[model samples]
Target: MPTFLKPIAPWLVILFPILTLPLKFFLKRIKKTREILALIVPVITTLFVSSYYSLIVNGEVLTNTVFKMNNILNIYFRVDAASFLFAIVSSTLWIFTIIYSFGYMKEYQNKDRYYSFLILALSVTMGVAFSGNLLTFYMFYELLTLITYPLVIHVQTEEAMDAGKQYLTYSLSGGALILLGIMFVAFLNEGVVLNFIPGGLISKSLLETGRSLEITLLVFLAGFSVKAAVMPLHRWLPAAMVAPTPISALFHAVAVVNSGVFGIIRIVYFVFGPEIVISLWTGKLFLVLILITIVLASIIAFFKDNLKRRLAYSTVSQLGYISLGAFLLNLEGLSGGILHLFNHALIKITLFFCSGVIYIVTHKKKISEMAGIGKKMPWTMGAFAIASLGMVGIPPSVGFNSKWYLMLGSFNQGSLLIMGLLILSAMLNAGYFLPIVVSAFFKEPITDFEEHQGFFEAPVSMLAPTVILAIATIGFGIWYHFPSLVVEVVVQNIF
Candidate 1:
């Protein structure tokens, strides 16, 4: 992409989140047109942004200075391989999400505010992906958490309100930690131009002094960990499950939480040089924590009975795998982890989207209530089955490939026990996901479902976006090799 167009791609990332503000006012005059307008803007922006970066993928880092405000504040952006990868993921999947939300939110009032935050949330996410400095990234990251709060509490009930408060509290605390990390980084890099350079700008003395490197890494990890839903920091996620399905779909799938995982990768590889991080005890400790998170979250998932809550816990377990790969401190682990970012994202989103549709059509939240739902919403629930199988790391889906490479990386680590934990987690994965498929398809329908031949699924808007995502999940699984190529390129060129 030409450097000029490169700047525009970052703009597209925030197109949704940014527009939401004005959209709220526009609805005073434009009212219901907001939905059609919502569909048009994000879709157009996604296409425009993707094409711009696709042009420059050959061997160039597209950079643009959006503003040179001052020494303290600057408008800096760039489209690198990493930025291109994440921006496209959000902008594209968000297009489908908006479509799904249209029918999903049709009956709800106050949609003006609803779609408004949806747009703003997306826009800031783009900002997070394309940010050029610690300062800029922190700004956008906070914006994402703040803007999505309305969506989290869209239902306006006592439970929804409580969930929103907890979400805000946790997310804002994360923002504070991130801000502290940014100050330390800026304090270290006082006069240098900022870029996603390998190894941070901090001096060696600071890194070695008083376990500073370990402490700094922990601050960033604790900051980013809240959203990534790492163990002990993940209570907010299941609590936030009280929101409507679309909100859950958007936030958990790729918007709110993905930003956290994305931030960890960006900080690890871009902020602290991978080599420096690996040489320190802090990095090794984080790796051990992620491995423990993977095993433990999977075990917890096995015991949850609420549909969204089970999936909520499943999200925690999957994120552990992503963290494990990122913290492994090698190419296989990094590549596997990065690829899992996309793989787990698509599959997990599909699972949540389908779950949302099931509740909308059936008024059911527990897995047991979904018995025989397969007969009602075959296409909808069928995708759920396929996605569940994929979650269990079954073949012919994208999740299988992620698990395969993750295990390969574990084996590469020469730890026979980590390899065992990998297998055990998959079995635990099956323990939660498999039963849902079995309950919906193999078992008799719940009594309420027996007479409901009149309906098979949620609205076309809801079911269509979900099934499409399910298809993308399977398709993206097999396409894992393509990202492997990109990861090889990142290593060869950047490292």
Candidate 2:
């Protein structure tokens, strides 16, 4: 790396994108300029993060403390293998989302406001990825909620407004619970610092408090689970599909929901540790909730004809797999969960991009209405089919690789129940996703005149990203060794 760039802390990966938000007004005066700036920030961040691969993977930790507001309330950021994995996934996929947004958002109103929040959300997401302590993580975590509200309600329609209100209600309530958990830990430890390590930060004295400790754990889990969209707390996500497609792809697939999944991993491996978390009935309770979420969300997806809505429910279920891997209390389990963190981002984003393409070019949103879409838009539907197969855990798809590790993790626990849950979930995934592919290809167009109209494809700008991500879905799966090594390196560091 160049000496000038060498001085830059990896945390600037977050700050760099944030600096763009203030420039929105000036950039907005020229539409193309604003969009290019939005795309450039994430692309630059991606390059910066790639520069750290050697340092992060070699276990050389990078730390920068931003502020010291007394002992318990300092702000800190650190980069490690695990955080870098998330940082790379978020930045890489976000570049494609920006590209997709250019084509998707061209005709939409309030492009300035939409781009600002999208950029800000990316900055805060990087914050969540690099946060060095609980206080810092919570700070960024809450800011993510505030910044994403505009994107959720970007349409400013009555339904969009309602969805935004529900999103805030759920997120704020979750934040309150997280704060309560932090207070309990701070009171017990005399400071609010909790760092990621194999053994958790909870002291023996605090553990002896028994019920109090359990309550704190449950409180923390409940708060973060809302974003993870686990079970009953997941209502806000499906409702928020009122937002534009790029926002849906970013928030539900990659950034927002993943924040919750990341939080649960931190709690399990960092704050509480597997030793303590596994010893409690809380582990079993969490496992049961994740299992319920996995099964139930897949079932819901089967019945929904609205494409984005189906994907929303699918995200809820797939997220359960991540949480399930964490709570399994073993290395194999943790590794599988973390691997899916990166893998699923690519898979889900491709699916959403395809859905957006379908809507933009054809004004079709319902799966039932897409009978001849495959013939009409072969490239778009082909990408959708490939991603759909991956979602079902088919071989040579990225989804299958993660599911393979998760199954091993489940069997390692000697829990037939979890093993069975994985199989059943895959079946449910196929139940919902495979039919879309089949309908697009094997089934005939519902209307005869459409066959005479011939084929059409989305704009190259819109089509290219989905195709690239779709290819990545297979390429990453086939060449799974490197990414698996990265994930294993991260899991090895923590466990």
The numbered model that scores best in TM-score is 2
Predicted candidate 2 versus true structure: per-residue lDDT over 357-433, tens digit per residue? 98888788899988867877789889998998998889899998889889999898999989998999999998888
Residue 20 displacement in candidate 2 (angstroms): 2.6
TM-score of each: 0.92, 0.96
Question: 34-138 in candidate 1: lDDT tens per residue?
Answer: 887777767766765666554445646766667776544676776776666677777778888888888778778888788777777777878888887777788
Task: Please identify model 1 stretches exceeding 4 Å from their true place.
Answer: 1-9, 12-32, 69-72, 203-206, 450-456, 480-482
- How high is the lDDT of residue 200 in model 1? 51
How many clashing residue pairs appear in each of the predictions shown?
8, 0
TM-score for candidate 1: 0.92
RMSD of each candidate? 2.8, 2.2
How many clashes in candidate 1? 8
